[model samples]
Target: MSVLSRLFARHVKPEFGKPGPRQEGGDLPPHLYGVIAEFGKPETLVHAVHATRKEGYQVIEAYTPYPIEELHDAIGHGPSRVPLLVLIGGIVGGLFGFFLQYWTSVVAYPLNVGGRPYNSWVSFIPITFECTILFAGIAAVLGMLVLNGLPMPYHPVFSVPRFQLASRDRYFLLILARDPRFRAGDTFRFMETLGASLVSDVED
Candidate 1:
């Protein structure tokens, strides 16, 4: 047996049945969407992610009950663009607020209240600060939602019965069918080799 196969064999419990043969077209279940591998620990999950990536599978995702900073690196997630969005929002808001203040205080309704300077930039600070905070806050929230594809009331991964444990104790690694390297049998075996406690199909 290959190294990977041996690695998987080491972890196979006699209680869990062997993985079934791959099916296709009419032979495949209609609900089958992808494959999920459940790991007993975060370290194993991280190792599995790295191994999967090394195998050239790009359409992979991982889930854990709590954050694992190393998992992000293992999965090769790029830096988030939310900060850039927030910065752009802040700049736009600041400019708009500053210009509005300038226009209103100097041109629209010039208050010659105390012979003080009409273009008092000091007074503009409060509104400018408020606008910057408001816009940046909105952008951070909306940008995060958009980037992360939030408000998702449903996901196919949830169809797996054991996946509910993902939010509790178990860590999961998924290999999406859309991946160029994916082959039902091959990917299933590959995940098996990563010491998965349970490897099951995900349904759409």
Candidate 2:
């Protein structure tokens, strides 16, 4: 074959719908957490959340110095499970306390004081109530912490210098990379087009 034809054939992509073999030892791209955008106002952050949701991005979070009630609905963020957890804990604690009291007075010790009867249901009320409240309070705090992902000393979003201001006055919105619709370049540009003052990558 002619040299010109040989060169052209060597450079041509391999046949029909089949992928060419990758380089033997190429490094993979770095992992990413997601993309984040900084906004100056609460309203703007809300707007961004709405826009992102409309764009079909489901995994979104907004950070502000103080809570914005509207954001709960904007991102389609679900209602918290802490309340339910607390209720369950309270019920369990109450049952345990009552049964323990029942077993001691009626089954094990069979105490009799002033002819008050071995099974004194009325006397157990105070301890049952106390145990219920104690367990419920603990459940509320623990459930909140677990659901909020506490003890996280590091997060990729913290890598952004301006994110420190999130607790002071600024507002921020993040779109996690796990979203099915996320494309780094496209999401970055999309966030910019929504009038964000700054946009940055969040490395995992």
Candidate 3:
């Protein structure tokens, strides 16, 4: 073969025949982090989630292509703490704004122009309002990130090749191995009973 042709073959072969994503376990000793069951229908997934919870699995998460209000009720996560965080942030910001203005007008740079009160309470309102909003917005974002564990570019579930369909048309229920009730073989069998289209172990 000509050198050009041989080089072209080598490059093209890898690109054209690139192996599919590695399977979930890939000859590893089944060091699993969880089991994910894929369902074709959202209703089935919701039922499976409820069943799993009823069966005493605590560390569970559901992935779906779209929002489903009923799913949240099934998952039963407790109330979020973001609102309290925002409220605390707003209160702190408002207090800081009020105090800063108070110090500036009364102590730091006292100005008695037109015999106006040095501690001008009315002028502090606008800054206090702005600061309240600014801090509350910041707290809302940070609290969400902290609560949701954001900036996590990768998770063990991503290792499952079939999981990519979760964003497209599939609903998945993941029962974490860390849950006290989880056993590799038993969980796999139980998931099969939940009407899952596909149930696979996830490796960390």
Candidate 4:
């Protein structure tokens, strides 16, 4: 079996149950996000992820220069709720569009044009369709941004000097301090034991 597969096999515990805390370290940034371990290779990064997961570090994420297919599974990414949000937005928009036209034509104006009824439901189709598409599109964009935590100009991970290489040829795994098992000092040492070339504290 490959190294990645072997590492995953070792960490087969399905649940991210909390583990005992390690001795807290003294050195911490004013606004600390987490500790990130820099790996020279993608394999090492994947290995580190499995190891961390085994230790119940659920609030962790990985960054790589490019997409790594195996990394997706390692990260335990789940289904997105964006589609549901978009559908609800579209339904709301359609209802709003239909009601607006109904109130304007049938209730308020009641214009008797060419002996035709004011509530021309057929005419509302085009506008209703357009409104549905418009709202759904808006929801998709906003949902994506909100879900991904975008508009964030700054992040502690970016504070790392070598993190810029994440766009070039580096792989990184970050373990957030929020994790129950995360002990600032002990976690840093754990990462070093994972064969990380560099383990740095990410400050906010």
Candidate 5:
């Protein structure tokens, strides 16, 4: 097996209820390991995120029932530029919309009826404004999804049973031990001291 696969196999547990012979060995290879901690209350979960961040683990993920603004800081996620992208796209769309109508009225079709001027300014405003909104809305949604890497229906972390509770009332902080400084036994021991309800090695 590759080093990454070996590391994952060593840490993540198989299906929670399945019975199998436990493998005994020395230290596991380096790979991402998630340590799940269950909390009864939102405050408890928030505390766990903060505590885990202070533990020096760089790779961490948190699951919660509702949006928690402070959690972004805990995970070290920086400000998102999706809004800015949408704004710029809207500006470009507005200009494109105006040009499309202008070209069609003046050069392409040039339907001058009832002594009306070929370059009609008032007639183009409605369509130009609508196009601006449509493009900007589309850009905002697609940009956010791409920036966040969305549409992933499955994650290795979801293989853990207790982690399923994350969508409900529970909060979870998973620290990936695959980081450069990760020491399997030492990290496990340290989490135990952090008052984790149940700290277990996650295996792939």
Candidate 6:
């Protein structure tokens, strides 16, 4: 190859070639502060969450099929204020809807065809309600997606073979070593004692 071609080749990725295996190293082991244990039954899972908390693991998250109200109490998660966002969206939409109708009917084209008032409050109520609902629904969907970091094409949890069980009646407790009081080896040993079925290092 010419000098220019060789230089360009350095930046290009090779296609369909036998690449060398990756040397697995430098992955953060589990939380290094706490381990996650999965439970077969709901009661067992709930008990586990309570147990883990008593053991002093600061960070914990539980995934279930439906809303488990008691689980939040067990894990100490605060009430999410996402509904406040929907309310704000609804208020804004209602105001905008009213303004649009007012501008068009009363100011832009004022025609009293059937002896009806230009600023007809009754006529605008339905439109206002529709706009309020529309904005609230849109906000809820978008807010949830944004907060969840959705459309997540890539996630470290996917690398774990058993994590897929989350959707299928399996409960998991993830303790992030990112907490202020986390230590790796001590955390791993604690998790093992907590009856973790399979404890492997969770990679971010």
Better of 2 and 3 by lDDT: 3
lDDT of 1: 0.80
By lDDT, the better pick of 1 and 5 is 1
lDDT of each: 0.80, 0.79, 0.80, 0.80, 0.69, 0.66
Model 4 gets an lDDT of: 0.80
After superposition, which runs of candidate 1 have C-alpha atoms over 4 Å from their true positions? Answer: 1-32
lDDT of 2 by residue, 1-204 (tens): 674343334223222223223222233235666789999988999988999999998867788999998999998966776788799889998998899999989998986799998878899999999989999999889767766666567667888899999999899999876676777677888999887899998766
User: Which lDDT tens digits does candidate 6 get at residues 79-161?
Assistant: 55558668887998899888889999999999895999999978999998899999988978876665455656765555667
Top model number, lDDT: 3
Q: List TM-score per model, in order.
A: 0.81, 0.83, 0.83, 0.80, 0.75, 0.74
Off by over 4 Å in 5: 1-26, 30-33, 178-181
In model 1, pairs of residues that clash are: none
For candidate 3, the 10 contiguous residues with the lowest summed lDDT are: 13-22
Candidate 3 local Cα displacement, residue 28, angstroms: 12
Residue range 98-177, candidate 3, lDDT tens digits:
99999999999998879989988998999999999999999899877766666567778889999999999999999876
Question: Could you tell me how far off, in angstroms, the CA of residue 35 lies in candidate 1 after the best superposition?
Answer: 1.1
Clashes of 1: 0
Model 4, span 1-204: residue lDDT tens = 674343333233222222224335576444566789899999989988999888878878899989999988888876666787799889999998999999999888888889878888888999999999999999899877766666666666777999999999989999877676777788889899999989998775
Tell me the tens digit of each residue's lDDT in model 5 across 82-196: 7776897799889989999999999999996788898878889998998899889988998777655566566667777787778887777676654444566776776777666
Clashing pairs in 5: 11-202, 11-203, 12-202, 12-203, 13-202, 13-203, 31-178
